[model samples]
Target: MGSLRVYATTGLLIASLSTLVHAAKLEDTAPYPKAEAGFSRQVIYLPQQSEEENFKVELIAGKTLEVDCNRQRLGGVLDEKNLEGWGYPFYRLEKVIGPMSTMMACPDGKKTRKFVPVVGDGFLLRYNSKLPLVIYAPQDIEVRYRIWSASDKVGTAIQE
Candidate 1:
């Protein structure tokens, strides 16, 4: 009976400790720099994922472009920059420029405003739920991201 009570108390203590750890804010961990003029700062907080699975974070930054059903690619890039003193990472989209699109004539006569994602060298960041991802972009553009992970199962490669 005494052992059962001890286990219950221990479980509650651990749960409370876990809650406290997660409740801490990113600013509390370290100071991230402020966004410069003409740029807006964005933050992403990823949930704690299973440790066994490999995970990555990708940034999707761009602007909406008006189109007539032609395939479009936004012209711009996201440059990864680090905080001056801390060396913490952040992304910057310098300018939002063109929506270079396929010249295919639109069969339909209607136009639509669509979100054109930016393409660059890339934005595949390491997944760390403990730190918040910070991004800065021109105030005219939008910033978004997606979390990617790999399954644990490994496939045998065919011999050459």
Candidate 2:
């Protein structure tokens, strides 16, 4: 019984020390502030401009970036649908994301309208910002972006 108690105490001490070490590591490497609390989401609304433009976005580890483009709006207005005179608004990421691209030629006319992600009612992109992302979008399309981060310590966005 004495030998058994000695072994048990040794094992407990090892376990406690390992736990403390791990906690220290977690504290040191944690990127988000108050990450022990949980994750958070940030949203951005981009309006149409006269020219095709690139928007730079910052990303962090363990967070995800999601983008959705609305093409059915009438005159760049959200929720103002016009079926008769529908314009197909679209965008392209500088980096190949998922199964989307500007390189893939989308045919013109009503048939081309079917190819838009907005027509399918799904997001144009859902990515983890491995690096800063550059998005290219048409002038008439409005974009809504949602970025999820695991830490609040990040405070303000270092990347726009």
Candidate 3:
């Protein structure tokens, strides 16, 4: 029984000290602030990737709407904002205004709830795994992202 207790105490000490070591290596999180009123902050933790510079992050912010059978799209301006003093990059999604759609009649007034994505500039971002991507958007807005990667082989442009 004495030998068992010694081994147990040693295991506990190793576990506790391991956690402290990992915690010390974690990136600082002091700059990211809480959400502002009427808006919520979203976080995206990217995984470490090889050659991350060849990748891009595309943020899609939009809302689901009941729509008829027509071509539809949502519009919002996604702007990049820098944190005060630290200059850490973050994104803010403006209010989604119009779901401009083609005015075509649906068969038998059929309607369906569809995720209409925002269409605008400033959505593509450079991929960096060191810090999490923070975004502030309206409470009603939904944010999503997809990763894009460049081809390994670079093609030279044709000379004019």
Candidate 4:
């Protein structure tokens, strides 16, 4: 009984240490604050069957992004630009929850939409700050984008 207790205690200590190490790694990787006035761009993907067109968005640091949908008409504003477009009238970005400091892309040439899960969804992209920006089609439709970056960190947007 004493040996079993010792083994259990050792196992518990190992588990505790492992958990601490994992937590430390996560903390180290936590998103850092963006450089002053820094901004990140995100592409909006519309569902294929929907009439709404895909669009590009630029978000400044310390700002929140949101999109939402209702039925057949789509409407939303970004970066102080209010846009009215046709499509699923209610489709709009709700919000972007982030501690993210990087951007990523899908290997399959799809863009990342705000509605898609950034961590564990099929649309989750591999983070890369250097690649051309692209937004995936919100639905099953094929759309192509060729973003031209004016600077290392900014790109010309394509809106349809």
Please, what is the TM-score per model?
Answer: 0.76, 0.19, 0.77, 0.17
| Per-residue accuracy of model 3 over 42-86 as CA lDDT, tens digit each | 776665668999778788888898988998898888889888998
Better of 2 and 3 by TM-score: 3
Error of 1 at 6 (Å): 39
lDDT against true structure, model 2: 0.29
Report the CA-based lDDT of candidate 1 relative to the real structure: 0.71
* Strongest candidate by TM-score: 3
User: Which candidate order results from sorting by TM-score in descending order?
Assistant: 3, 1, 2, 4
How many clashing residue pairs are found in candidate 2?
1
Model 4's lDDT to the true fold? 0.29
C-alpha positional error of residue 59 in candidate 1 after TM-score superposition, expressed in Å: 0.9
Q: What's the C-alpha lDDT at position 26 in model 1? A: 57
Name the runs in model 1 displaced over 4 angstroms.
1-26
Better of 2 and 3 by lDDT: 3
lDDT of 2 by residue, 1-160 (tens): 6965675466446534544444434224223223122222222222222222222212211112232332321111112122233332222322122324334343442233332232222233333222112223333233334322232245666776
Worst 10 residues of 4 by lDDT: 46-55
Model 3 misplacement above 4 A: 1-28
Clashes of each: 0, 1, 0, 21
Q: Which tens-of-lDDT digit does each residue in 1-160 have in candidate 4?
A: 6965675466446534544444433224323222222222233221122111222213221222232231111222221221234111111222334424334433555333333222212222222322222321223222222211122356779998
Residues 1-160 of candidate 1 have per-residue lDDT tens digits of 6965675466446534544555546577567766888888777766666671487877788778777878877767677787778877777778766777788887777898888887765567787777667788888778766655565589999999
Error of 4 at 158 (Å): 75
The alpha-carbon lDDT assigned to residue 31 of candidate 1 equals 77
Model 3 steric clash pairs: none
